[model samples]
Target: MKEILVLYYSHRGSVRALAEQIAHGIHQVPGAVARVRTVPRVSTVCEAVADDIPAEGPPYVEERDLAECIGLALGSPTRFGNMAAPMKYFLDGLAGAWVNGTLVGKPACVFTSTASLHGGQESTLLSMMLPLMHHGMLIAGLPYTEPALNETRSGGTPYGASHVAGQEGSAALSADEIALAQAQGRLLAGYALKLAVAR
Candidate 1:
């Protein structure tokens, strides 16, 4: 079976919600499976640490996950128009993988959530792509043909799947957002399976 890593960080559970939908789509493709993982939160105070394993949710990701996966789906909540500090911190620690080209030619996509409709989902997605590009992964995105991209009023984007969590962070993901995310995952898994077979 070909495994696609679904890695993410979620604060209010919005990004994790999207990640699960993406994983569900990945499983829709024959011979493809999703390996869900999450990163730990960063601490502001010096020397602060999180448990090696999260209390609930997926375990913290490791470099081995990147090496073993056929493709990647990265997610994080938007933080000031960029990926959250925890996700960025995790990526920054991947210089060894970048140098070794471990992710080269792999298909990768990004997803994000924000508090408002105008809360920089596209920019956050773009920002997350930069490190993957450096690691030589091929960036995958939602095409306009995925009708949900055109119909979404809340948070779908050409860059990737997204969600607007509202001011109090209570807004559920719109149906269009869910559809687009699933479509992106299926497309990525299909492409990865094709490449694996070709190899």
Candidate 2:
């Protein structure tokens, strides 16, 4: 099966919720599958280190995931209108992949979650794209053709999928938010399949 890497950093589970919904969409396409992975949290203390494998949820992402996947879906919680430090730290370590063009010509999509409805969701998605762009990947976003994008009152955008986690950091996704996220996954997987066939 062709795999699309679903990489995310989620603290309150909101971004991870969106990632699951997006993975569902990817599964809707035949011969396509989602490979969900998460990064370890960063710490300010110099002596702290994350375990080799996380205790819960998906396994920590490895370099092979990037080198093998046909496409990518990146997600993170909004951290002051940008991707969180852990996600940034992970991306910054891809210099060797950048030099080797490991991700070149691959299709990619971005997603984010925020505590408020106006909490820089789009900016976070855009920020994730910069590193993928540097890796020579093709960036895609939802088009207006998705009805949820027009009907969503909570957290869906043309730039990518998003969720309003509420001030209390709820992880429940709205109906429209779920629909849009699934739509994004389907779109991303579709692109990956098409490119694979073309090649």
Candidate 3:
């Protein structure tokens, strides 16, 4: 079976919600499975430490996950138009994966959630792609052919999957957002399976 990693960081549970939806879509593809993981949070206070295993949710991701996964679905809430600090911190630790080309030629996609409609959803998505590009992964975005991209009133983008959590973070993912996220996962999984077979 081919595994696709669904890695994310969520505050207020919005990004995690999107991650779960993306995993749902990955499982739809035959021979593809989702390996869900999360990163430990960062803190301003010096020497803040976390347990080896999280109190809940998936296990903390290791560099090995990148090499093992045929595809990757990365998610983080928008923080000033970029992925949140913890997610970026996790990516920064991937220099070993970069030097070794552990993720080279793998399929990857990004997703994000924002507190406002104008909050940096697209920019956040783009920012997340930078590190993956350095690793030589093929970036997949939601194509316009997906009906949600054309019709979504909330969160959906050509860059990747997204959600608008509103200022109070009250809004659940709209239907279109859900559809687009699932479609992006399906697209990534299909590509990974095909590429793995070719290799």
Candidate 4:
């Protein structure tokens, strides 16, 4: 079985919810498994060391996960229309992987959560994609062919999967958001499976 890395830094659990849905979709495809991981929160004062293992959901991501996974799904919460600082800090530290081409030729997709309907969901997804693109990973996006892309009133986008968390960050994903996210995952896994053979 090949593993697809589902990596994210969720602030209010919304992005994490999307990551889980994406992983669920990856599982639907045979021969593709999800390796879910999360990045630690960053400190504004100075660099702080997080516990080796998180107290909650997924474990913190390691550089090796990028090297080992056949594909990637990167998710994050929107902070001023971009990915949160923690996710960006993690990506900024990947120069070694960039030089080694650890993620070259791999398939990747992006996801995000925003506090408002127009809270930069697409921009956040695009922000996360930039680093992956620099790493030479092929970006896989949600196509309009998906019915949910046409039907969603909440959070589906042609750029990627996304969710609207509302002000208190308590909004649950709508059915359309769920379907679109899962479809993105399956699409990414399909690309990974086919590309692995070519490589």
Candidate 5:
């Protein structure tokens, strides 16, 4: 099977939910599979350390995951109009991959969740794209052709799939949000298949 890595960081489960939906979409395409992974949270205190295995949810991603995956779906909750620190930290540590061009020519998509309607989802998505771009990956966004891009009132955008998780971060994924994420997964997987065939 061709695997697409769904890498994400979630504080309140909102971004994780979107990641699952995106994985579901990837599985819709024949010969495509989703490999869900999460990043460990960073501590401000200098002495803190994360366990090798997480207590719950997906385990932290490894370099092997990046090397093996055919495509990538990166997600994170918005942190003041940017990706959360843990996600950024993980990406920053990938200089070796960048130097080796491990991700070059691969397809990638970004997703995010925000605490409010204007919580900088687009900017967060843009920030996530920067690292992927540096890795020489092809960035994919939701096109107008997807009805959810025009119809979603909660959390879908041309930049990528997003969620309005409310002030307390209590919002659940709306139907439209789920559909759009799934659509993006399918689109990305299809593109990966074509790229594989081209080679």
Candidate 6:
């Protein structure tokens, strides 16, 4: 199987829901599988550390996952028009992988969730893309062809898939959000398959 890593950092489960939908879309491809993973939270104190295993959800991402996957689906909740600290912290530590070209030429797509309509969803997605681009990965985005992109009133972007979780941060995805996310996944997996063959 050509595994596409569906990696994310989610708080309050909104981003996680999008990741699951992206994985479902990846699975729609015959030879593709989603390797779901998450990153540990960054601690405020210098001495604070996360457990080796999380209490729930997907396993923490390893450098090996980057090397193994043929493609990537990156997701995070928005933080001040950017990706959350934990996800940024994880990406910042990947200097070794960056040098080794562990992710070079792989296809990548980003996703995000926000607290309000103007909560920086697109900026968050774009922020996630910078590091992937630095790694020499090809960035993919939703096209106008996806009906959801045109129809979504909640959260969807040509830059990536997104969701608007309301002020309390518990809103479920609208139908269009789900559709666009799945389409983004399928598009990413298709790119990965073709790119893998080309490589």
Query: What lDDT score belongs to each candidate, Candidate 1 first?
Result: 0.92, 0.94, 0.92, 0.92, 0.92, 0.94
lDDT of 2 by residue, 62-127 (tens): 888998899999999999999999999999998889999999999999999999989999888888
Model 2 residue runs over 4 Å out of place are 44-49
TM-score for each candidate, following the candidate numbering: 0.96, 0.97, 0.96, 0.96, 0.96, 0.97
Candidate 5, 1-199: lDDT as tens digits: 9999999999999999999999999999999999999998888662276578898898889998999998999999998899999999999999999999999999999999998988999999998999999999999999999998889999999999989998888748999999999999999999988887775
Query: After TM-score superposition, what is the CA distance of residue 85 in candidate 6 from its true location, in Å?
Result: 0.3
lDDT per residue for candidate 4 within 68-159, as digits (tens), equals 99999999899999999999999999999999999999999999998899999888888788999999999999999999999888898999
Backbone clashes under 3 angstroms, per model: 0, 0, 0, 0, 0, 0
Whichever of 2 and 5 has more TM-score, that candidate is 2
> Per-prediction RMSD in angstroms?
1.3, 1.1, 1.3, 1.3, 1.3, 1.2
List clashing residue pairs in candidate 3.
Answer: none
True-vs-predicted CA distance for residue 62, candidate 6, Å: 0.2
Per-residue error for 187 in candidate 5, Å, reads: 0.7
CA deviation > 4 Å runs, candidate 3? 44-47
Stretches of model 1 off by over 4 angstroms after superposition: 44-49
Taking the tens digit of each residue's C-alpha lDDT, what string does model 1 give over 120-143?
998999999999998988899999
lDDT of 3 by residue, 35-154 (tens): 999998888552266677998999999988888899999999999999999999999988899999899999999999999888999999999999999999999988899988999999
Comparing 3 and 6 on lDDT, the stronger one: 6
